[model samples]
Every structure is written in C-alpha cells, then in structure tokens.
Target: MKNILQEVFETLRDFLSVNSPEQSHMLTVYANLDQANPLNRKERPAWLIELKNTFDNLSEEQKNALMTFDGASLTWNGIEEQIISTLEQHEAKGRSVVVFTDLSDTVVIDLPLPVKTGVYYGIPQVKHMLSQLHRYGQYLVVLFSEREHRTVFVDVPTLVSEGTLQSSLGEGIFLRPGGNKTRTQASERRNLDTERRMLREAAGEINDYFMDEPLFDRIVFGGNLKIAHGVKNNLHHAVAEQLVSIEPIPFDATDEQLRETVSILADEYEAVHDLALIQELILRGETCGRAASGMDEVMDALQNGQVRKLYLPYPMDADDFDTLLIEAVLENVEVELVHGIAAETLREMGGVGAALYYVIR
Candidate 1:
C-alpha cells in the first residue's frame, strides 16, 4: 500500500507538471469497480453505467474539445471502448479504478481503497483520489521484558507487522556466594543493574534501527510497565517524543494478540489526537489565532501557503471541497481526512478547517 501511494504521488506530480495549452481538455475518470453481485457476471456494472451517463451529460463543445484536442487521437466512442476493454482485461477485484488521459496518454490505476466515483473534465480531480490513497503513518511497537525484548514495526492503517527485532538478555547469574545476607543483597543489586543495562542496550538498538529507516510515526511500548518506562527514558529525545502509549501485554503474547493490543491502543491514541486537533481549531478560530475555520478563511490561508495542516471530512461530495483539497495538496500542505467527532465538528465549521503557520494580520 505504501508503494502504491508513492506511485500515485509520482503520478500526481507528473500530471501537475504538464504545461501544454491543450491540457485543459484532459479527462479524468474515477469509477468504483466493486461488483454488487458475483453471480450475475453478465450484468453491466453500475459504475460503467454512471460513466456513460457522465459522458452523455457533457456539453457538445466540451465533448468535441476532449475528442479533437491536439495530440489526442481517440474519439469519445473510442475512449469508452478502450476503458471497457482495459477493465475487461483486468480482474474486477479492486475497490476503484482511476483513469487519467489527455486523450493521447492514458494511465489507469486500480486502487485498493474506494474513491469518489465521477468524471472530472477540464482539470484532473485528484484531491479526493489522493486522500483515499493516503496511508496513515507507521507505528513502532516495542515489547520489553526482563529476559527478552522485541521491537515490531507496524503499518498503522492496516495494523500489519512489517518486521521485528529481538534480543535475549542473558540469565542473571550471581558471581558471589548467596549464603550470607550482605552477599545476597549485593547479588540482587548486581542483577538489577544487569537488567537495567540490558534494557538500555535494547533502547540503543531501537534508536539505531530507526536511524536507518525513520518512517514510524508513533511508538507503543508493551510488556513490563517499569521496564518499558525505563527503556522509554533511555530512548533518543526525538524517538521518545513519539511514544504514545504503554500497553499491558505479556512478553509471551502471540502475534495475533500483539497486533490486537497495538490496534486498540493506536485507535485510542488517534481518537484523542483528532479531538485535540478539533478543539485547537475551535479555540483558535474563536480567539482569532493562527487558525482558520470554514471554507473562505481556510481557502484564503491555503492560497497564501500559510496553512500547515488542512482538515476535511471524509467522503465529502461537494465540488468546492474537492477544489480546496486540490489546493491543499498542490501546496504540499498536510491533509487529514478526519472522522467521527472531529469530522462532525469540522462539518459544523463548513466542512473544512486549517492550522496556519501564521496569521496574515
């Protein structure tokens, strides 16, 4: 999924770079490919019907411009036939299919996630498509124990473990005689020191691991709480700041159990994060701070490149929302498709808001 998103980003970049005067006639189509009935294989899919209807609805001038644009050889009928042929050749398994063409060059992308189904003529409506393709940041789950410690890298959106690092702390052996009380106390202290040393080393290993691939957005610690906290304190400041939660998972938990624990904690963290963002936006808007709520102010902030983060409700149907999203992406602003309470609050604020870098005033 990450690789697929990277490809989509690259495609978007290429599309944005085109400078031809005839580029205005480019047609981009987004279609939901999920079939409603598996048994009725011969039935025409609903999305295909919608696509045909969209073509039929376009003005004659618009239709002619698309078909007869310079460098474009395919007519409207030829374009539809090619779309059908290409779709037929591929298995109808993905959630959506996106077609981008200047009528000369066509790029079809079969996405794992669903996107808004429609025809976007004149300009490529890519904001919604990119938003759907966006994957949340990765997670680093570290399970610490007295005897063994493990670090599991997780893809937060899918809750799938990418890989793991593990190390065994050697047995706590007392070198001195334990028969005497003083010697026994000293032995216990030495064992504690050994455990702390092992944990510190494990923390160092984690730092090194992420230094090579620093993609994880959040960190979760599990197993022994005391040990986890100790390791957390030992981590680098940058990595330590990413520590979101510490869960009560057993050191010997199965893969499934670990994944479930991480998922639950991650979801909780996200909910809190979303709520906080919404609250900040509300407060800033009321106080006239570096925040903009509602479409007008947010769009103005986005145009000036002052928006640091743009928040929008998922699955918004309005064309204006699409335009705002496109502007946000083109400016390299962080776009978050909020949901639940955050989305509801945003909808009340005209379905969009932004955290700005600075207020123009």
Candidate 2:
C-alpha cells in the first residue's frame, strides 16, 4: 500500500492539474478534526462553526460566485451540507481534513498528521498541506540481527508501515568442536568471515531495494548494534548517505516496539536536522552567502527564484507565513516546518528563512 506521504504527493499533483480560472471561486478548508470531542458527538465541531462564520462574512460577490458556480445544480447551502455529511461519516477523529472545491470538483483528504487549522476561501491554499507532507516524509527502517534482518518502510508522522522490503535469514555459522587450540582459532576465524559475508549480502539487498524503490527520505538502522553498524559499513554510498541513526533496539522486538523506537528516533533526528538547517542559515547569512533570514529577505529570495529551500516554524502565527509559504511552493522550493528548539530559534529570526541557490550581491 502507498504511504500517506506518497498519497499526499499524488493528491497535490492531481489538485494542481485541475483547471482553475482566475475568476473561479474556490473553498479550501483545513480543519483540525483531532480536536473534536468524540464523547460529545451531538455538538457541532468547532471547525464547522468556523466555516459557517467564514461563509457568512464573505462578500455578496464571493457568495454568489460560489452559489452559482454549479449553474443550478448545487448551491452554497448544498456544498456546505455535503461538507458536513462527508466529515460526519469519516473516522477522522485524530487527524486533519482538507476540503478543496472549485464548486465544480470537490476533493476531500484526510491527513494523518496535524496542521495549522484554518478556512481559506480563495484560491486553494496548498502551502500548509505541502509543509505538513514535507515534515512527515517517508522513511525506511532496517532492523539487523545475526539470524535474520528485516526492512520496513514507514510513514514518519503516522507510524504506518508502508511495506516490508526484505525479511530473511542469513547463512548460519555454528561453532565447531575443535580438538586443539589451532583448530579452535581457525574455526573462530571462519565464523568471523561468515558473519562479514552475511553482513555484506544484507547491505547489497538493502541497496538493491532502495534502487528499485527510492522514495525514502531517510533510512535508519536498528536492532543488534554490532550487526547494524557492520551492514552500514558495507552499504553503497548512495544508500549510506541517507542513514540517520543506528538505534539500540533488540533483534526480537515486536512490531509495536519497533514503531515506537523509530518514532522517537525520527523526532530526534528531525530536531537535529532542523537545528542544523538553522545553523547553516545563520552562518551563511553572517558571511553574506546563499542564505536569507527574516520575512522580507526570504520573500525577496523566493521571488527571485534563488531559494533552494524554505524553513518555517510549526504553528506559525505570523500573518505573512502563508504568503511566504505559497511563494516558496510556487517556486518549487523545498519547505521544512521546523519544531522544538529550532522552531524557537527560527521564531526569533522572524519565523522564516530560506537557503538560496546563490548569493545575491
């Protein structure tokens, strides 16, 4: 099955493909369904109420445009009813839902990860959607052991297992009964060689799997630290470069345990990743290199198509955050929604930054 990240990418592609004219009216609702009280099913969701208020506040022109977009088939009320009914039926209690409609085609998506919730009643606002997707990118976990090794692909935010690429035992190397010290030493040497050979084979299999399916943003190794490191050493440079961490999980860990371990590791890795990016931005900015910090500089860089990547804090409160995000996405700049200490640091630095393709003199 395709992971949530893959599904989001496909959805984004499809959404962008739909023809949307300048005069077309679009309703984009990003609601945090996870905040709904499951116990109080009778109460209207906060998001629905917010949407109602937003709709009420729209100008007559906007309302008329939306109501008449379907040409007598669907009205504004009908569209609202559909949204309510669809959301009511779906089991999206702990997730965010995005509703995009040009009044002709309506697409609803349930996001496995949480996002900054709001109702955008203009052109489809895909910045938050794309940012969330980037934050919870796809990853691979390789759990190595002496007897067997397993490879599992996971969606980082949801901890949902996409699929297992490999799960097989290696050649067994048993200790031999040696009569003399010389024979015992020889047997030990043979066992070591066999182990190395098994590790090399495992690394080759992993490299091949990555080559065939290269959607993984990060790769982690867990279980049997010795074997994990051994396999890491033998991995091809392309695969090795993506390795984030070698965790100390047991070889016989249950699926739940494995997921939990990887989840924590992924978060830590992301925190470190965010910090490194922020540091890079700061260092480059200091030296007048290819980096821009603060809203104005970042926006200028994005407009110039000089931005290679944009970094913003999660739960951005800045009024221009979405505008910056939209510009970055339109420019095909990589977006990273930072959290934790890095996010705090970014907020201090005007809550937005970008790594540019080149320094602007």
Candidate 3:
C-alpha cells in the first residue's frame, strides 16, 4: 500500500514538473466526487453529474479538441469511469482530471485539495506539492550515543531508516578500573575526553553524510539533551542552522521507534514552520514591503514571474485566484496552502502574499 502511494507520488511529481507546449483543450476538472466511506457510495455524486454537464456544455471547439470530433473515440462516460476508478485505487480524497490530447498519457492525480478546477492554454498549472513535498524527505535525524550514532531519514508519505554509525573512540576495556588511584583518575579523564571526541567525530560523520547529499531542511538530534548539544556544537554551521529539535531515544532504536519519533517531530516542525512563514509574511508586508499581496498585486507578480513563494489561505473560495495560482506554479513559484492562524494572517494581507524573486518596480 505504501509502495502504491509512493508510486502515485512519483507519478504526480513527474506530471507537476512537465511543461508541455502542445496546445488545444487539455481538460482539467478537479472535483471531490466520491464518498469518504465505502458504505456511503450511494448513487452517482453531484460533482460527477456536474462534471458531465460541464463537458456537455463546453463549446463545440473545446469538446471536439478534448474528446475528439463527434466524440465516438473517447466518450465522457468512459473517461468519467476511468477517473473515478483510478482515484479510488489511491484512496483519493479529491479528483484531478488532466485529460490531454495525448490520451495514452492522460491521468488523474489523487491529490487531496478541495475541488477547485480550471483549464489554461499551456501546461496545466503544476503545483508540484510544494509544501507537502518540502515537508517530506527534509528530515535528518541522528540518535547520538557514546557507543554509536544511529541515523534515519523520516519523510512524508513514507518513513525511512538510514541506519547507523558506531563509535571507535576507545575500543575494548579502556575504562577498566585497576592500578593506582591517580592512574585510574587520569585514565578516567582520558576516557571522558575520548567520549567527547567520539561525539565530535559523530557530528563530523553526520556532516559528511550530507556533504554529497541534499542538505536536510530540518535536523533532529535524538539522544540525551546534553550529549546531543555537545554533538550539535561540532556540526557545520550550515547544518547546525537547520536543526529543529533534540529528542531522546535509545542508542539502537527500533525502526518503529524511529518512525514514531520522526512522525511526531515532523508534525511539530510543520506546525512551527507554517506559523513562522505566516508571521514572516505579515511582518514583511507591514515593514519591509516585499510581500506582494492582495489578489491584484499577487496576480501581477505572478504574471511578471516575480513571485518566488506564494502563500494562499486554504479552504479559500479560490475561483478568483485559481488561474493566477496556476500561472505562479508554472512559473516555478512555490505555493503554500496555509490554514488556521495562517489563514487569518492571509485575511489581513488581502488573502494572498508572495515572496518576490525581484521587485516589479
């Protein structure tokens, strides 16, 4: 099941990155047309009916371009069934209909956004799950210990264990108590130094782990607070800055334990992240004046390709900004769907904001 979801995620990602130039009507119908509970699958959904009506009402040109002239080759009935069945397989909460002229490559993505659909001339606005994907695969967790250092990569839609690194600080009976008290004390001091060195070495190992790989957006140290801090101090400043939280776990944590820890931390990190970005948007809008806000300003920024990150309040009546949202996405802008306090923040900023790639002055 996890593998299936992963595969879906990969497919969605590929579609999101695609910037196809082939023109003509590429029908996009995003609708929530299924019951959440299987038992409630009573009758055809209103959205499906509405979707069919939508197609039926399309201008002759749009209809012909979408399903072909006279509509014999690909009927709406068959396409609707295909969309529903595909979405159901992925436990999709919402429907995304991307039926291109190239029917063989047509697909329905099971992204769980509230149904708000639109169609544009060029590439369908590919959001690429900017926030969700960013949240996932961005954690680098290390469980530090004097004996060994264990690490795992916990990410979205899936949790992954990255394995471990055992310490070689003082191998075999280095702390055996014997001989004179002074000698014992001196050896004890040496052992303590060795322990610190081992931790430092662990930090270096962690740093090296990310040198060739993409740097994690968040780093979590999973061990004793003091020891985690000690190891943290040795981390490269760039990596150090990405640190999220310190959590205590066993030196050799089970995969389940690591997964649980990662899940909890990931949730907490996203919460803080949403709040921080919202506050920053509000703050910047008020003071620095960099946040391009309001429907008009945001739309203009998007069209001018100035928006680097776009913040839109979730559960919004997105009909007004849907086209602009797609334009921003196709322009490679990062789009975030913020809710709760963040949603209220957007209300003050005219319901949208953008971090500009460059001021449009």
Candidate 4:
C-alpha cells in the first residue's frame, strides 16, 4: 500500500517548504509496520518504546510530546483498509503528526538501495529516495497524440494521468468528394499538417520537462503509432536521444491493458537503459579515466567519495556486496544494477566498478 507513496512524497515536498526546528525536542519515529512483521504492528513497537524511553531523559516538552503520542494509533491510521504497509511518523509540539507510507521500500533506513530516512523536521531527507529510485530506472512514458500528453512513470503506472499535458490544434478539416477531389485532397493535407503540428508541439512540451531535470532520462512512446512516430521524428534532440522504445499501448488503452503494456515495455526499456549505461561507462572509463572497475578499486574510490557512479554487474548475495551498498549510500554515490552483457562486462572487472570524481587524463 505504501499508502499511495506519491501522496506521501508530495506531502514531504510541502513540509520541506516551511522552516521547522532541526531538533525541536520533537519525538520522531519510523515504524516499518510491515504486515509480515508482527513485532512492528504490535501495540508498542520495540523501536517506539525504546525511543519513548530515550525521551524521558530529555526536557519535559519532549517527554510530554512523546507521552501524548499514541504509538499504536500511528500504526493503525489507515491500517484497517490495509492502506499502510510501511509507516513513518514525524511529530513535533504544536505541529501535526506527519506520516508517509509506500508500497515499496522508499527509504534507506530499512532497505539497502542507497535511500535515506531522517526524523528531523524541515529537512528534505527524501533526496536519497529521489536520486536512487531513478538510478534503478524511472521511465517517462510519453503517450503522444494531438489532444494531450499522457506521461507516466513505468514503476508507478496508476499515476500516469497526473503530470499529463493537454493541447489542441483545433478540429481538422475532413475531406470528402468526387468533383471536389482537388479541394478534398488539399483539405486532407491541411488536416494532416494540423495533426503533425499538434504532435510536435506536444513533443516540445515533453522535451521541456527533461530540460528542467524531470530526472527521468529515458523515454518510451505510447498511443497512435503514426502520431507517436511523428512526435519522435520531430522531438527536440535532447528528448530524441533518450527515446528507448515505443510501448504497445494505444492512447485509449484501459488501466488493466496499460499495466500489461507497461510490463513488457518496461522490460525493453531496462535493457536499453542498461546497455546505454554500460557503453557510456566503458567509453568514459577509457577516454576519461574517471571510471574504476574491479572490487578493490571501486571500494577504495567509494571510501574516498570519488565514485561519481557505481555499477554493480548483478545483485550480489554475499555480505561484501551489502557492505558495498551500505558504503555507497553513506557516500551518496550513484549505483546502477545492471544485467546481461552489462553484468558480464562488470564481472570481467571483478564484479564492481565506479566512475570516479577525477580522470587520469
């Protein structure tokens, strides 16, 4: 349920806008509340109890806040509908209790994916979530048409309609006739021109998003092939360069159908993204001397905060891999989980590699 992570994410953005105390003697806690973990759901989670005990040593204001907060109440908010799988609450005196949930591990506190969690109010701790989630891959699926731009992130398909853009080229002239065939053909030409114009204008709007760092570097086309292709053809070079593939979904595709379409298209997009990253890593490693391959070199670079990017050929099951992942997050390093030939390439370099802060050249 992540209880609709997007809502939590949006709330976090709004909360960050105001200045709250760094350590306002506020009592903050992150309760996993994973249904599978009973301990987390109990009346008093051990973590919360321990935190409560710690507050007793602080000033009366902190103690009062912690004492008044019904820890179980926090866990049960939206729990009846199974809306919350993981819950995090940030509380302060004279401030409302703020909670965020996600269907996936959006925080590094519990997961090893370089995500971060902080109890301090007014701090944007979600930077870790924002940066790492996209690194794994977040696609900007552009469903192009003359009417509107239906953009979606592959991972979160339901929210596709949110950032959508709308535009119109006015109604196109319809062609019909025998004696007026010449006029009809001209009308047809005009209509197609209008269609093309609308598609390109939509593409330009989509391109504007990337320029502003939508952070979704990969693009997949959806909707009518004719219009989608036209948009692809006319896309600003920046957007065109990142076009991965086209999704087999019509503009009017239903939610269920779009979900299925996204599944297949997402797989293809990942392959494309991984291949592109691998090629870039190799070319840059050789040309710029900024990338390091092999475990020892990568770890050394990570320890020094020189690893601009990290490439793990495949998911490692060993302790060492976990250690590396932990170090990467602590250092705020960018990591990509690669597969297939990309994995093979990294394996050739001792199963790990890093793009560093400096180039030997």
Per-model TM-score on C-alpha atoms? 0.73, 0.72, 0.63, 0.55
In terms of lDDT, the poorest run of 10 residues in model 1 is: 169-178
For 247-308, candidate 4 gives per-residue lDDT tens digits of 55677666666656666666666666777887888887888788888877888888877888
For model 2, what is the C-alpha lDDT against the true structure? 0.71
**Tens-digit per-residue lDDT, 1-361, candidate 3:** 2233345445544554462423423445555544663433656655555555665666656654555622448775665566556544544444333332234455665543334443332334344333223333457777755444566876643657575444444331122234666676677877778767766776777777765456355688876566788878888998788788887777677878877877777667666777799888767767767778899999888878778788877556555664565565456565677756777877787888888766655
- Give the poorly placed runs of model 2, Cα more than 4 Å off: 1-25, 30-75, 78-97, 104-119, 131-139, 151-154, 160-189, 317-319
For residue 207, give model 1's deviation from the true position in Å.
1.9
Give the total clashing residue pairs for model 4. Answer: 4
Tens digit of per-residue lDDT, candidate 2, span 124-231? 676667656564456788776556666676776666563655534334212233456666666778877877777777888888887777567788888778778888
Candidate 1 C-alpha error for residue 197, in Å: 1.8
Best by lDDT: 1
In candidate 3, residue 276 scores what lDDT? 91
lDDT value, candidate 4, whole model? 0.53
* Residue 111 local lDDT, model 4: 25
Which stretches of model 3 miss by more than 4 angstroms? 1-24, 28-65, 68-136, 160-162, 165-181, 184-189, 252-257, 314-321, 337-339, 357-361
The TM-score of candidate 3 is: 0.63
- Candidate number achieving the greatest TM-score relative to the actual structure: 1
Clash pairs detected, candidate 3: none
